[model samples]
Target chain A: MSLTYGAIGWNRQKKIYDLVLACGIVLYLSLFIGLGAWLNPGATVETLLIRGFGTCALLLLHIVLIIGPLCRIDARFLPLLYNRRHLGVTTFIMGLAHAGLAIFQFHALGDLNPFVSLLVSNTRFFSLPDFPFQQLGFGALVILFLMASTSHDFWLANLSAPVWKRLHMSVYAAYALLIAHVTLGVLQAETNPLLAAALGAGLASVISLHLVSGSREVRADSHSSLSSFDGAGEFVDVCSVDEIAEKRARIVTLAGERVAVFKYDGKISVLSNVCQHQNGPLGEGRIVDGCVTCPWHGFQYLPDSGASPPPFIERVPTFRVKVDGGRVLVNPRPLPPGTRVEPARIDANASG
Target chain B: MITFAKWKLAIFGIYLVIGAVFAVVFLAIGIARVDPAAKGSPIGFRLLIFPGVVALWPYLLSRWIGGEHAPRTERNSHRDGSGGADQ
Candidate 1:
């Protein structure tokens, strides 16, 4: 049907984020030359390629994991939710580079040899007694390769979020396999007890934090602190004007929910207590460099429009506020972004 | 993003262990072989975990950990429906 201006703004923001990522990728990859000189101590093209690709693969994994909770904790993360496929594809490219170097560094020789080192290197796959087991890591890496190759928007769009989600759910499977990859291959081939334990613990910790956070969120969903504001058509009584300082703000409970009302530059404004992003309380948050920041995700909003920063257009409705004779009155009338209203101006010169 | 506090210290501990393992293994291999240079592959190899671990971690974590909590309970979402919010 019809396209809203908010939609247009989101498209533009995506483009800006993409461009910045492109610049970063280029700059980061170019540093291989400097790294080769420092790390290898002698100039060799093979060493440079292998080390660079290895580092790239590691970094890509971090970026891929970062986007999800970021959005969950904050509503502003919705924009990135749509662009997640791009991130997947990027991670896949890094995996390809790592694999390419791996083949070249260890397995390449002049012939139609079929590159047997892939399955044959450690000899653990033969299942004979005293086998090294690193062969399992090789197989696991192959599975990782397949998963990486399919990471794309074409697949996600065609598969739908659930099927796509199910397929990507294999990441945990892939993670388990990668753990086998490290323990079976790197630990056995490398033969260092401390390193093996360290790698195992690292992956374990990441997984554990996820499990704990997931459990906490399960309980958190049933309750909303703002539920009291559930509209018996009753306004929450916070305090007298004497209690609120000049050019400042105070918070109160209305219904079961919280609301923040600010008297700034002698004008009154009201907004939801929680941030549209990470649920950061507007009451505890502050005006930083002129805009209100959520403290949790740094989401900023203007009191009047409740619109997010430029290049981003998500908006939260602003409610009506009135100061009647010395009493504060808040009507739960929320206007969509761009609505203009005249607010009563307090005398800047008056002390009380 | 990562909560970045506890996760980091754990990762650091992991790195130290892996590094020490590589160092010890390479040393042992060097000592065992009479001519280590001739028999052993000089190529230093470490673990290469596929890139997707980073990408998939957040989505899985949030899905399992964060759940689908309503973004903010501000306006009545179903204002058009009866008894939801006074328009």
Candidate 2:
């Protein structure tokens, strides 16, 4: 909510969040190294550092990826999403450490530039098991570096939320690259089936979580579309007024656009489901302080005009609505953004 | 050993030059565009984020120059407005 960013707007909550994160990382690393040393006395310090940091970064990436779908499934996970950029930046740093040690230990002694050696050392791209896995890891690291560098509100505001979001979505590509890098690199060298099975399990869990969340959203959308329109011209029967929980909304697709009809304060207001900032789902969010709050980042809009409150300028398209025979009906034609349409008042005498 | 050292030095030199160029650009844009509310941030905070600014200067510059001016009315009047559920 800052107009000018001097640095990060770290509050008490953020301070606590970061403190816990730092302590967790330290604990994880110490335990990992200690256990590895006890289990394999022959393992060198360089090997331990490489494996520990690499595994830690991979684990963090999985956590970061799951946070999105997890939040969609349950609102309790939103706290993790709030400070996800910090986790991403820490993951990048751990990955950088792993790359640094691996290059220094394996490629630095050769009579070639370590950077060049990383690119050309194993030019067996034609061979499945013998491919240059380091190059894939390097590519994924570059993407992570880009994401971490731009993980600030300054970039989000300047880049426009949509473009910023698209840029960050490149993490999925990076995740895929890293999976390949590990499968071809570490898994090939390590003869242990346990490590390979764990990696496979992690990948499957991530994929399954995404699939389940996606199916839930599809079901919601399909349910909205299943309601048949009244024979009345132009106006469609979305749902009964009672079907929408108070302060929440019933989202329906009309004229190829998703519109959220919110029931609040004994009145119903229809607005475009897409939020003006970051395109968050407005239907999923409840009304707070008489404004429709976006669940993603808490961007708010006046339900009637679909306009953000003063000092912040954002608006969403509004739709005309009418209530007849206890059924809420909406005109498919959307009004221009910021247009003030009268809300359809719910009748007190209507039966539930 | 000598050849390896030479290659390492050459790579280091190239990186230094690139870093210097980006640092200057970052300082210019970062000072101009940082949020006014962030004025309370300490000098140490600014220094901490300086490296990130340098790495992402190209993106910052593009966004600063190309601001989002199209109001919702102009864009969403006729267009189908659909926001992503996961975002």
Candidate 3:
């Protein structure tokens, strides 16, 4: 959103976000280590550190995985989404600390290189009790490290939003790896069914949240398909004008391309559902100041032209729209990006 | 046993070399893309993101070389149908 990238463009909200996150991490670690020591008086400091940080990182990762779905389910959770990358980076740091301490304690003094020992010391990859679980953890750590490093908006801009999103989606893979790592590594050694159950619960929670949010989105899309075509097929009927909320849109997929037909200011404007900036859902975003604001990053475009207002050069394809007998009809063919089309105005006396 | 140890050492050495090369390239890219709002020295930011740069260098390098600059609007396909579906 800025012309130039600064350290983080930290504002009051971000500072508060980081401070709260720091305090929470410190509190969690203190309680976890304190409780572990109280429970087992003979537990070593290294063991406490390893377990505390590992559990903290895993917990934070569950939060990270659920944030998107949580936001989708409720708009109130959007604030968490705003500073989610910080949470991710913090989780990676905690995971790294846990890994580093484990390596130092378990493998540093060995004759072989610690990493080599990690990789080759346990060759029982398929064996339940002796499997090389550290490798799975190491693989997950690598993925998390990649995600944390490129969590910046600079990377998002440069890599393109779709690519950046795809890269971040690899977190699911990392999650799977970590789950295997823990189930095989710690759960086996500890002989604790509670630990296994907790991990299973986390896995279930993440899956359920994603499923719920995904189903909601699919239902919305399905509703948009209830349309009839005109005799000429030149303009497809999307929905009735009354079906659209003011300043909102009805998104329709026509000929494989999605178009957002917006009802605003007693006029209808059709534009590509994709935002030029991050391919954010323009259809899902409400109009702000006569422009469609992208829900993801607040990037704006004039609905008529599908062009970002001056000084911002981004553009999305526009579609020709018309209102016929209270029905909104949009042409399947998209106009060249940045091409201006007059909006079809609703008469003052038009009925639903 | 000796041959096995030598193989392990060889693999470790190769990993170290690769790690060092990635670290160096990461440092280079970090300097170029240091956050403006970041406080403290550029080196600090570089160090912070060093691991990320190393792991994501291939993708970052493609972006660094102008490979990812195509506008998203131009690439939209009917199969994908743009935003809400993918998200």
**A34-116 in candidate 2: lDDT tens per residue?**
99999999999899999899999999999999998998899788778767889999999999999999999999998877776
Tens-digit lDDT string for candidate 1 (A1-352): 0111111223566577677667776677778757657755776777666546544554555445545555444546555555555555565566567666767767676342224444344454555443544344344445555465435322232233345557666666655655555555445545557666666566655666566656655554333223223245544334455556654556664433456666666666666565643345565456665555664445676765565656554445556665545555565544554243455454532343
lDDT for residue A140 in candidate 2, whole number 0-100: 90
Could you tell me the lDDT of residue A178 within candidate 1?
Answer: 52
Q: What is the lDDT of candidate 1?
A: 0.49
Least accurate stretch of 10 residues (summed lDDT) in model 3 chain A?
A: A1-10
Lowest lDDT sum, 10 consecutive residues, model 2 chain B, at B78-87
Question: Candidate 3 docking: what grade?
Answer: incorrect
Question: Taking the tens digit of each residue's C-alpha lDDT, what string does model 3 give over A1-352?
Answer: 5544444657788899899999999999999999999988999989999999999999999999999899888877877877788999999999999999999999899797777677667788668888889989998998998798888765676556778889899999999999999988898878668888999999999999999999997886676663467888788888788898999988887655567889999999988887766566788788999999877667898989888888777777777878877888787767777778888777742555
**Winner on DockQ (1 vs 3):** 3
TM-score attained by model 1: 0.43
Error of 1 at B68 (Å): 31
Clashing pairs in 3: A5-B36, A6-B36, A6-B37, A7-B36, A7-B37, A7-B38, A8-B37, A256-B78
User: Candidate 2, after superposition: displacement of residue A197 in Å?
Assistant: 1.2
Interface C-alpha RMSD per candidate, 1 decimal: 21.2, 8.1, 7.8
- Give residue A168's lDDT in candidate 2 (0 to 100): 90
